[model samples]
Target: MLRYSLMRLGIFAGCFLALWGLVYVGALPRGLGDSNLLWVLLLSLVISAPLSFVLLRKQRDSMSVEIVEKVDRAKGRLQDNRTREDAV
Candidate 1:
């Protein structure tokens, strides 16, 4: 789970840095280099989301399986405790 999340963050960071670099190089509008920080961040997120969705599909599936297994185990434990209490 941690690995998947960190990887997603790394992707976003990479995109953000790349965007910032483009802005720095005058490829994007000149004023947004430092003046429009929020726009830059929002654009980065928009770009990163689709990339992460495609790139991290396997990681996300693995994390989902791990989470589901943990939930099932916890539910089973809860049922066992309930049975013990009812018997008492």
Candidate 2:
């Protein structure tokens, strides 16, 4: 979970920096002027932050499901071992 959170943070930071750099380099047009550009960048960050968070959450959920399956398998093996020991 911690790793996933960090990964999402990294992705958000990278995207924000990339967009800022594009705007600075004149690759993207200014919304209207300095103020507009700032506003647009802020809006992009706001939107991207939540979208990334949701994506990370979905990824985490899938990971959790995989972990749960592994744990269940291990538990079953442990129970079988205990049963064999009892049979002896």
Off by over 4 Å in 2: 1-52
Candidate 2 per-residue C-alpha lDDT over 1-88 given as tens digits, one digit per residue, 9 for 90 to 100: 6777687777767777777777778887667655755755586678678778677887888779988999999999999999999999
lDDT of 1 by residue, 54-74 (tens): 999999999999999999999
**Candidate 1 residue-wise lDDT at 85:** 100
lDDT of 1: 0.89
- Model 2 reaches what TM-score against the true structure? 0.47
Error of 1 at 65 (Å): 0.1
Whole-model lDDT for model 2 versus the true structure?
A: 0.77
